[model samples]
Target: MLRPDDRGVLYGEGVFETVWIRDGVARLRDAHLARMARSAALLEITLPDPAPLVDEAEARWRADGEGALRLVCTAGPAGGEPVLYATVTPVPEAVIAQRADGVRVVTAEAGVSRERPGWSLTTAKTLSYAANLAARRSAGDRDMLWVSTEGYALESPTAGLVWLSDGVLHGVAGDGVLPSVTVAHLLSEAGGVHGEATVADLDRSDGIWLVSALRGLAEVIELDGRGRARSPWTGRLSRIVSRRPG
Candidate 1:
């Protein structure tokens, strides 16, 4: 039970991880836990042993067949042990549709620069997502691609950006963006580069995708009202990412 006085309820002091489950197994479970642990450390929340939590999530997966498992850790009532829990739910149909049909995206100013201080929380997957949700609402249907105040492409409200140019796969990299496990896995399998990108760079790229845990990869078919030719690599890359890793 969550108390009103808990720091997570009162001030969003928490971290979370959403894992994609298939065939009674959680995909990238170790990577997700590692990232969650790092985020909890950054927030000064003591993380509980995740073995029991993983067992709970696995039980849900065994029951549901396919779904998303969300594990959360919150700073429980100040001066007390942190609250940890996990929940499982079906993956949204819309997210699945986006993977098949792709998505149209709009670029928006993020109002922040890429140069963040060492203490910045931008890289942490915390519970404070009001700003990101607000930006998505303002996009009004299409997904919003957040660009830094310096005009460099950062990421989407809920996903990471990856593009291909001259047969080279590239991922967005900077202090302002959250590290994406999905993107990292894809890059490791496909081989890629990590660097800063501008809107113009993406505009001319061979392909673009918004990668996430639940959604996997959604191609960007249109951007700011301009339509792009579907890339031949989309199908091949999708197959690469869909394979179950050992």
Candidate 2:
């Protein structure tokens, strides 16, 4: 286990990946590691060898039966005593069920400014997730939208914001702080993924859903506390991918 005194705990330094593990296998292991490596580089943190981490995950998966995996990499202890820690947690049935029904998401966006230097932390999965937690809490009335100050639809605390326009899958495009592996795979497999959409496009639509690795995809029955059932496409998409548990 990673210590509370580790650099991640102390300075909230280092990147992490919440990779999903199910059926005795880990999904998108390569993409997650690649993102981690990219994030670590942006932070100028030295990443430990990936082989050991891979071995650890495989061993733990075989030992613990299997579920979802949380991979965390920090700067380690003050003097470099702590190393990266990996843990496995069983995937909650509720998560899958919610995905089945589709999760509602409040529109949220990340603000990148000259002072904030978006490149510094926008892409890295740092432990300083207080803002995200706050975004979740700030999601008052359950349907609140947390869009960018500029009104661009960024993403949700736990899910990527995916919308459909003219039968096309349009998602937000940027550094991909969106945690878009599932969507990425969806677009790659299904084809025709358009990024760089505006919140106006989403609002003009019939509905929207919050997306994530765990929840997969959940529909937004409402937006900004408004009661709206959403388009039939939500159920259709959910069902279309039901047979394949990607």
Candidate 3:
């Protein structure tokens, strides 16, 4: 729980990870732990060992099985020790439906500053999610595609973009974007195309997907009012991610 004066509550001095649990096992456990450690290090926060957390999650999974699991670490109140906790939540029915049927998305010029300003925690999964949440709200029921000021596709609020073109699987370079673990794993299996993407480039792609931990892989079926037929690879990719590492 957060105190009124906790740094995470007051200043968002925290990081969190969302993982998928299936058959009493947490998928991508190592990758999520590594990313949390990196984010904590970047924020100069001392993170506790994650082994116990993983063990506890596994125990919970054994009791209840599949669900969404969240791990949160906070810098705590001034001069206080850091706080850590884990929670499980039901995976929303809508998310499951979208994963099966794909999502209809709309692009919005988000004016994201890729320069990684001094105050920018872009590379870290920090607790300050106001901007990300707001952008999604602005989409008015449709998922929002974040674009940089220069017309490059950055990412969605909670997922990374991976598109296929000319038999090449293209992923937006991690430089100005969050280094998405899901996308990285997929690229390792399917090979990768390293580059930036504009709206037009995305339009010309053979397939496009929004990848995340919980959602796994969701194909983009429509964008900005234009409809795109579901790609033949969507089901295959979904199957691959459903068998996610445990």
Candidate 4:
């Protein structure tokens, strides 16, 4: 149980990692942990040793089962020790469906300036997610693509954005967007470029995808009511990222 004064509970001061578990093993475990550590450091929260929690997650996973594992570290009650915990749960069916079928997206103003000073936490996976969740809720049936006040495409509420233009892969980059582990892995396997994007650029792309740990890659069939032609590269790229690391 959490204390009333815990900073995470009282002020949303925390960091977390959501790992995709496949066949009882956490996929990209090291990457997730490294990101979490970075997030913790940004918040000045000392992360506890993760080995015990990782072992516990491994023990809970069934031989051939799949799940989502969450590891959380939070600022403890006032000046107390930082709190840490882990949980494993089934991956939502909707996430799996989106991975196979694809998703529709709508771009919206993020309401925050990407160039704002002292906002280094923008790229961290911190627990202050109310704004992100609200953006998704506002999008309703379609997922939301957060854009800067200047019309530059940033990223989605939960996933990173990647697109194919003239047969080359590209991703949204800079301090404004969260550095996506899934996108990095995909791009490392299949060469890609990283730079700023605009709605017009996305509209003219050969294909667009929302990349994440849980969703893998969801092709964008439609964007802002405009239909996009399916790219032949989707299947080939998906196969590349789906391969388990040796």
Candidate 5:
């Protein structure tokens, strides 16, 4: 439990990672911890050794079976150690269904100034998610694809974009977007580009997929009410990421 003055509660000072677990194994645990450590350093929050939490997450998954395991570390009350916790919850039906059925999305202005380059919190998964939540709420039932004022596709609130253009998978340039671990892994396996594209340009692609730890690879079947053709690569890409390392 958090004290009344916890930094995470008062100022949203913290970083978090959502991990996908299957058969008691937390997928990409090392990559998740690396990103969390990078985020903690950027925020100047003292991150404790993650070994205990990692063990706890694995134990919890063994007892509870497959689900989403969220690891949150935050700056707590002044002069106290950072607060860390692992919460495992059932994966939402929509998220599971989207893995196979795909998702429909609408575009929105990301609000943040993507034109001005900087190493700010945009790359970190911080608790100050008010803007991300607002974007999702604005979308209602559909997912929101954030685009810059210059018409460049940014990313969704929680996932990264990967579209197939002329047989090449492409994601938004790493400059302003969060460097997605999932997308990076997918690109390493299947090959892709870190570049910019407008919504119109993305729509014309042979296939569009949203990559994330939990979502795996969900193709964008419809964008802004326009239907896209089903892709043959979705299943192959899914299997590539879903492989459980021995």
Candidate 6:
């Protein structure tokens, strides 16, 4: 948790990512670290060497069981210094199972600042996660958290852009929000490209997914607070990830 005195806590300011590491190997560490670095640069904070952090995470995965990895960087409690860290943690079995089965989702307008200037760090995945966390709290077990602003579906609380349209891959604006490294990786793996879409477009697509590194990928089995009937594509995506070279 973010400490009270932490700048990222007092004022939302930082960037972080949950990486997908399996069998002690991170699937897309480079992409994630590069994104983190870009975010830190945008925020004007000095970044610690991520090589050491990745080494540590890899060590832990070897010592522990296979699972998810969460890397968080804070601006420090004083709010004006470089403080970065990362951790390797297990993806909840239940969460993974849910991903395998698929999840329900609700889209709500994001409270992003006009310029996103609430001392808030929209680009940085900082500790000031109150609003997103609250949205998650209000979400049901099957509910995949979503944030939209001005009628545009931005992203999920902890996941990346979810776009669903026949064979055309889609994602939100790259510069509008933080770039989703995991989403990018999946798009590459699927031999697909990122396209754009509306919530309605998603609803009328061939598949819907909440792509993240830790969970690899998740399909939205339910939508608009309704339990959507299961589809075959969900399992197919899972199999694809499973067969992917680690």
Better of 1 and 3 by lDDT: 1
Instruction: Give lDDT tens digits, candidate 4, residues 155-192.
Output: 99999999988888998875567789988888878889
Give a tens-digit lDDT track for model 2, residues 189-212: 545475655666776776576666
Q: In candidate 6, what are the lDDT values of residues 165-214, reduced to their tens digit?
A: 66656666554566777677666666667666667777777777887666
Residue 57 of model 4 has an lDDT of 91
1 or 6: which has the higher lDDT? 1
- Model 2 spans with C-alpha error above 4 angstroms: 1-5, 55-66, 78-82, 108-119, 140-145, 175-179, 239-246
- Write down the lDDT of every candidate, Cα atoms only: 0.88, 0.65, 0.84, 0.86, 0.85, 0.68
Location of the lowest summed lDDT over 10 successive residues in candidate 4: 111-120
Question: How many backbone clashes can be found in candidate 3?
Answer: 0
Quickly count the clashes in candidate 5.
0
For residues 148-182, what per-residue lDDT tens digits would candidate 1 score against the true structure?
99999999989999999989888987467889998
Q: Write the per-residue lDDT of candidate 5 for residues 172-206, one digit (tens) a residue.
A: 77656777988888887787777778998997888
Candidate 6 residue-wise lDDT at 20: 72
Candidate 3 per-residue C-alpha lDDT over 1-246 given as tens digits, one digit per residue, 9 for 90 to 100: 789999999999999888888777788888989999988988989999876988887886654546788999999999998899988877777787778888888998877655667656788888989998998888887888888888889899999999988888888897668788888877777777667889899898889999998888999999888898778878777776778563
> Which scores better on TM-score, 4 or 6?
4
Shift of residue 26 alpha carbon in model 5, Å: 0.8
Better of 2 and 5 by TM-score: 5
**TM-score (all chains, Cα) for each model:** 0.97, 0.82, 0.95, 0.96, 0.94, 0.83
Counting clashing residue pairs in each candidate, in order, gives: 0, 12, 0, 0, 0, 5
Q: Model 6: what TM-score?
A: 0.83
Q: Over the full model, what C-alpha lDDT does candidate 6 score relative to the true structure?
A: 0.68
